[model samples]
Target: MSRKPIIGKCRLCGEIKKLTFEHVPPETTFNNYSVRILSGEEVIKQVADPNNPPWDFSDTKGTIQQRGRGGYYLCGDCNSKTGQWYVPEYSKFVHIVHSALQEVKGKEFGALGIKMKGIKPLSIFKQIMTLFCDINEGMMGDNSLKDYLLNKTSTNFKRERYHLYMHIHSGSVERMNGIMVQFASGVGLITLSEISTYPVGFALYIDKPEAYNPEGVEITIFSQFNYDDEIELEIIIPKLESNIFFSGDYRTKEEIENAIQESKDN
Candidate 1:
């Protein structure tokens, strides 16, 4: 009988004894309808395949089949400990934000309208901001030490922070507006490009495509709101380096203008 070859060390930790397979994006989040659509099932299935999976997908030949499908290896230890940031805690945080938004909407329109008008509106906005901020801090915080031969030091701590910031300021905000429109009526449409341009126009550039070195990708945000109470948000992250595309929706044109003013004030 022929013996199977072992794949090398863990990406995060350089342990030589037993390497655990890790998912670039956690598999638990992959099952969602949005994720499945965004990351096609064929791509997922190919990643999950035992024999001819992607380099980021598997460890050993037979070991891949042993793990069934959906997940890769990390020995026993790294598998258990890796990627805590993008797992249950992040999901829980998103749920909290959604719940808070619901509570805001449940109040009488008159009270809610008043809340949105005055300085006290800062209090409500603060609550929303706090939840996201805490989530970002918790997930991207420093990792605990492991005393293994290759796993002694920390891994990708800075990159993880960048990812967290991108997810919050860019991804989460866009997602929140979409969820608001899905659950509530009378939300004017805003595109992702509109929102992204707001910061760019104000010269508050938090992220850029060139900074990340993604070949030729260009990202921009936009938003749109109609007088008839419809909201639409679109984000264009094109592979063409020359094209700038980003978009999202705001509650209203006044809101968008106010946000720009707020950005200036800050």
Candidate 2:
């Protein structure tokens, strides 16, 4: 059977037109895998061995099968423009993350100082941030993001005091964690996140300037509008949050609520 093209409202422009699959993290990281798409939930996970935190997940076997087969939400124009404007920077960042992971195999993350050049921080930030919005709009059926993506642009991340924190992450059990997009609300702000579970794992935290920082974790606060030429980055292996969990063990809604509370208490 042949499938028909989807005619829909553009996620960015709101124009009624043909929509296309906007790979949440772009296709470079997902390798076009057919996977489960989850919105408003965590994909179940375990640490494998809590005692062995650095379990050399770099070589773990498995394919990330939960990237949600990409999301069909953007019109062709918005999709193409985003690709041209942001995907290249995204690919570069993904490559840097992969290299950083290989360098710290069997070792602790962070402590390794990384510096990148000729980069547009906002371009990359917008790319990741869009995935969160795309999921909210397409998967969760929300409209708040549509208006933001089109007009209400804010270039003053530092002035507005909003920051994006990032880290290198790999799935502890099998490293097949695909690009996972999640939304966490409460604690005085909203958190929109995207994580990749490949050996070169990544966590990008977008939160309000006043949101509570998780206890004991030191994050590098970065701004979108500031770094157009160079970006100073460090790769820390982030612990899985209640929102972004490993994929395997299922969590009941109640259990998930408990975990979120635990995170807040910390």
Q: Estimate TM-scores for all models.
A: 0.27, 0.59
lDDT tens digits by residue: candidate 2, 72-146:
778888888778766788778777756765676788543445556666666676676566556444523434445
lDDT of 1 by residue, 214-250 (tens): 2211211110111122222132212111111122222
Best model per lDDT: 2
Model 1 segments beyond 4 Å from truth?
Answer: 1-6, 17-24, 27-73, 83-86, 97-164, 167-266
- For model 2, the stretches where C-alpha displacement exceeds 4 angstroms are 37-68, 108-112, 138-162, 172-196, 199-211, 215-266
- Lowest summed lDDT across 10 adjacent residues in model 2 is found at 38-47
For all candidates in order, the CA lDDT equals 0.27, 0.50
Residue-pair clashes, model 1? 46
Candidate 2 residue 177 C-alpha distance from true site, Å: 14
Question: Residue 24 CA error for candidate 1 (Å)?
Answer: 5.0
